[model samples]
Target chain A: MFLKNRNIWLLAPAVLLIGICFLFPVSWLLQRSVSEPVWGLQNYITIFSKTIYLGVLWNTVAIAGVTTLLCALIGFPVAYSMAHSSPWIRKVLIFSVLIPFWTSILVRSFAWLVILQRGGILNDFLAGIGLIAEPLDLVYNRFGVLLGMVQVLLPFMVFPLFSVITRIDGSYFSAATNLGATPIRAFFRVYLPLCLPGLATGAMLVFIISLGYFITPALLGGRGDIMIAQLIFERIDEFGDWPLASALAIVLLVGTGLLFVLVNALIKIRGRGI
Target chain B: MTKTTPKGGLNRRTFLKTSLCASASLAALSIGTRGAFAAVDLSGREMVFASWGGSYQAAQETAYCNPFTKATGATVIQDGPMNGSKLRTMVEGGQPIWDVVDVTDTFLAANEELFEDLDFNIVDASPLDQAYVHAKGIGCIIWSYNIAFNTDVVGENAPQSWADVFDVEKFPGKRALRDRAYPMLEIALMADGVAPEDLYPLDVDRAFAKLDTIKDHVIWYTSNSAAQQLFVDGEVGTGVLLNGRTFDVNKKGAPVDLTWNQNIRSIDYLVIPKGAPNAEVAQHFMNATVDADNQALMANTLAYAPCNPAAFAGVEESVLPWLATTPENAEKGFLIDAEYWRDNLAALTERWTEWKLT
Candidate 1:
């Protein structure tokens, strides 16, 4: 009935625009993944048959998981502090965290390359103080990937946590304290539980984003830390094997989507309990 | 898709190259007839040329783009770091946006059928010597990859050869090499005493074996940006570098110096997509890029030398030494066997992967 009363043609241009722009290309990519026109299943077949593809997938998941965990570990405390800090302090903290997000992620990844390179500023400082004989392997390795990924994805965690934490009534913390709970107990019991949804959402966003990350790992990661996006990029660009690259891309998309759904389902279950 | 014969495939490769040359020259002749295309006012037609976007963007605009508009009249667009992935998308997507593309030497033969036969007719090949390719216009010019060193780091006494790069005991500090294996293997072999000319028909196993000798000392950086930055930061004393990036870094005050003593060169052809809307225009644009004055301007801008041997005429003698195409450098530099690299990289990449991690 609402559709009957509406001017549907108003939505036609935009709907057609999106469908033509996005859906068709995405469908074509997926189609290539499964059936390379004549070479049906060859692309998908190659992915499973090759150990390198499997290694890449594992590296993607491991890097994403570790980065997500690290973002949570680091972000939660900052969010907690900001949620309780003066409004001015909260604004300042949020602004500072949000600043890196404004710059391109590729630029930020290169910055990490500068900081973590062997004989880089960090290593130079360490060696200057007689900390070690040789500058350690810092960039072009797993450690550099983590440092870059976490830096790029940190705001995604911190922002959402701040939103959830900000909504909690101070009265709940006061009431728990009035009931003879310790300040720490009252703070955690009242504040942290309220922030779980945002925390999960932040973690899920960071995880999904990191799962498809290409640049940071490509630039920073050593041989073992190669990610799926880089594999897809190479398959298409380097090897010119479009069908296999498309297949790898579709698998990555499906995997990321499934993980997002799973995380959302968990969030929903926790939402009900809350 | 690979098969080797009883003293195999070399003859077939030669035959294919010859046939390709004949057909390309024929097409180039017909397109060379300027009056046939003179009436087709290109003012309304849009063209996009993909090149490595940087100072190249400026050089291309002034050299090819503005002059093309002034001469024949057309809208020109530029894109770049062209590879097969981007080409596949443009072609297979059925929306061929680019009329011309400047691809690396490696991509030329690998995606063989995707490109339109270059018209020798329209493209002014005068600047290119007969010896340019053993055959001209089959492929023309592509930017080269060379090892750039920090002059301040090396000081007055610099390493002349790849051997100096790997001589940690002699020219000591930290050393950097490109993370990519192509030049790495070649340099490693050279460092380990393989003759420059004997470097290809590459001995992959021997190259990797030599790479192993310097494994602990090599701090490999992947990106050219990072490779340049490492020198900028004074992180590593020396590294293998891209020619254009080295110049850019030196301009940015990184105190870097480059040696073409044993550089590997890859030739990129000016070719069109099979379905390019403006194939004739693309060929003409190629000529504009190769003109002596334009070539000199492009060299001054990007430091990538034009393949047109004659284009160097107008360039000053003082600046001639730094140009990659200068005989002093070009004679010494080996033209990269891109076909060999195209075929072997994946296999060597697999081995390199295992070697690095293991």
Candidate 2:
């Protein structure tokens, strides 16, 4: 703290980059939201009053919530195994999780369509095996959207849980079991609670990322699965309605900010309790 | 003709002047036998030509841009899979990289201010249909939302109308439709028994009601490429698709085909963006797009109907039936109302989203 005069200059380039690239554009967007189509809160008013905007907002949150829940459920066991397994097994697990991440979201979404559409490879294979007489509706629905999003977002959940679980002492669970608690009871009471911070971090990452998803939902989801990002794109691309688009973006930003603050407060409260 | 300027300092105007002088001498020598581009020679100039990339733009390059270069001596640099918002931003920033951009009629109608007015002296729109010509742009191709189907899926019972497409019992299975509001509303109304001529200031409530009946059956597609794939793969039995997109898949031996009944025609326009670096060359490029021979080549390759009526003479016999503007085909369909869409796009699109959610 005493010798920080020159050390602060090291932050100069990053600060300058953020100021020019991010902060400037964000502030400009903020200004555009209010100033366009007459200087008032008309854009925000329209967003709030309109059922279309409100519905899409609800859809975005609902989809993100479901996606986060799914990632957490699927990621927990895999992450637990990765953390507890031998070095070679851990390497294999990490590679499997990360290899898909390297592929573009657009390509992955298209791949899902190829595999999951009604006349796709899955249905053909299933029909060949006499699993069913009729092809099932797979892609182009809420289910497909979840499947696509969960696969892409699972890594965000797993890595955090893996790091946290590895750091956790194995004695916490053994101690609970020695105190006359059953294995399941000991795991739930001692182990799960200890993993909460990592779970919260991963959930936050997945939920927030899912909230702004565009390509996966557009490609995989049904008509009703339109999200806020898609709406923003349509406003700008189709109509060139920047004011409304900017207002929608600001709403998303503010909503995510509030959620983040709420989660931080909850974590602090839990810390105090402990 | 042999005059040389000082090395390394020839600006655009000076180069144009030098070319003009050279052309003047050549024209004088040729006397009464002046070729088509006798007055103009853009030998040293170059302009960027932007369009929706893929086979469509590739066909345009072979048909329009190449010929324009041959006639005018200006190089046309190909760019873009044209995106609307990016074009708007580029023009608003007053430094558009693209000189001539291929845009839809609706986009041209909505954002007229973003484009340069056509220099009538340079671009001759006389050969084209008057309806296709605009003050800010020239119609390059006329395509339509057609009642398309996979022959394999529908078997012997082919869908001939929008009503049949809406009739699940008639043509059973999942059907594809565009995810936009403009044409969807129009399509829904037409399916509900509204006449083609009567589809103006559209009956919105009635359209939604019609759409609701087939809501569960529809596979809404945002991209035309995806729509083509759907038809090609026999995933959709019958639905609405663009005429050119249908032709592309069908040419590749896909079982897909289309009907001309109640097709909704739309135009793609080539416009010079405001403050474009080579607006002069772009204006001449527009003239080349209207040439009968070039337009015929485009129609032959893509089956996107040419705006120039004379281009039909050079069109192949097989491609004639697929074209939207053939006399018999033209009588069966109507152009989409770009003005109405320009006014109602935002409001109705919101309503569309609300309807979908419900």
Candidate 3:
């Protein structure tokens, strides 16, 4: 839009930087991934034929699905509470939601690892209280992975839902109440309908992100809980099998993205109908 | 924003200095290359030796860097944990970053393009043996991965052998193992009755079965580093790990012991990129690296035995028991068949994943 001399001159530098930093590396990575192996789909085929890889993929989807569900369940209520509260309460609640987000994800994941590890604080507390005679297996399991992921990704779901919830008019609920609707009935007709968009957006964000999560699963999950990201990383980092890793990455992107898009479309249609 | 040196002035000064530095750097680079196979006096030139950045790595720099610089005039710059891919990129990108890398022989075997061959003519090769040469002295250094246990956790009924490591009833505590499948599987198989000598041409099914028995007791580390940290954290009573790390805990007064009866020994080597600009200089540095004095310095810092046989003369007798290459240590442990693994890494690693999870 700006055809001015200074602005036109700035475009050259901006384009130069973007081309150098982003385009060059991505192009090289693409070329390497496709060519590094036997130049065909051998690496990609290996991903499907490989039972371990498929199992890891299945576990990754399962963990992401569970995490997204948990985030939605926990986040929905908080968003509801904030939406119904006074402005002061809403501000305080939002601040609380954001407090943990400021800390590093690594720190948060490590904190959960400590709590969930065998002989960790949680196990010690349980044993001390005579709840169990021995420390139960906790960390390095599916449970630990879920716990860490839910903590890291809860805010992603909550905030988007909060935005939509806050926009829901109190008048709509009051009118439904006045029109012979019970509190629960009024909420179903008004609150649920109003919060649909935010819920969809938040759920999609969480699901898509959970698909790509690397650190939490690797750190917390046991051997059986290996995820796609870790597998892709291993292919490239450990084996130096660039083509295979790229193929894995490509599959992950396509599979996770398609599922997310399909779900988003379904939700959008249903929300519109409601 | 106020009165300051103009853009032209700044550019001119920068240009002049950069040109001077570039010429000086070119001359130094050429000199190092021309004397590639010769043991040139390192007294004036600064040399950068790369390593896996850690405590022992720090010791290597302290013991060798300062002393080597003082005595030889080679200002040593210690860099890195070995990364073959990253090094390749640097060499390919037109700037050679590291001259000497402290990497494992396994890595050199897997990624042969990343390191310069040792100049055996100048670098003393007399200390190394037939087995070591066949193993490729630069690709991997002779090192051990052994069984370690917390003395306090196991008490008087300490693990006599790796059989003791698997004895849940005897050594009753969480057992940790490195996340890798290579040496760990071998340890598991040995515990399951496979002779160490017969471990070559690995029996996949038997190895998996052995691993399965301890899967319940074994806390397999996804991050190898986590194995040590877990033991140090007192979460695990017993584990199989790199002897160096297990030794660190013992040195630090942790109640731990290393069982080398069935320890795995392998070499980690050094190499130059296939088309590296610094290949010639790298070869010179490699020559300096394998020198008896320098290799001895590496041993003192790393605790892992030095590759140069001559370096053994410098290694103290007190440390001989721990060095992987000592006649005592070498007699017990067999060389890791890297060639077999090199041929079957892809297939076997896939099997390793299934075995670990299953």
As a TM-score, model 2 comes out at: 0.92
lDDT of 3 by residue, B215-318 (tens): 87767776656677677667888877777777666777878777667777887665555454444445555544444445555666667777666566556556
User: What does candidate 1's lDDT look like per residue over B274-332, in tens digits?
Assistant: 77777767766665555444555556556767665545654555557666678888887
Better of 2 and 3 by DockQ: 2
Expressed as tens digits, the lDDT of each residue in A13-55 for candidate 3 is 8889999996786677666666765566676677789788888
Question: After aligning candidate 3 to the native by TM-score, how far in Å is the CA of A182 from where it should be?
Answer: 4.3
Identify the leading candidate in terms of lDDT.
2
Segments in model 3 whose C-alpha atoms lie over 4 Å from true places? A1-39, A84-96, A102-105, A180-182, B1-39, B42-48, B64-68, B90-96, B133-141, B309-321
Which lDDT value does model 1 have at B109?
A: 56
Q: lDDT of all predictions, in order shown?
A: 0.71, 0.88, 0.69
| Candidate 1 lDDT for residue A87 | 88
List candidate 2 segments past 4 Å from native.
Answer: A1-6, B1-39
Ranked candidates, highest DockQ first: 2, 3, 1
lDDT string, candidate 1, A161-208, tens digits: 988888878888889999999999976777677778889989988998
- Model 3 residue B135 distance off true place after TM-score fit, in angstroms: 8.5
For residue B242, what is the lDDT in candidate 1? 75
Model 1's CAPRI class?
acceptable
- The ten-residue window of minimal lDDT in model 2 chain B covers B26-35
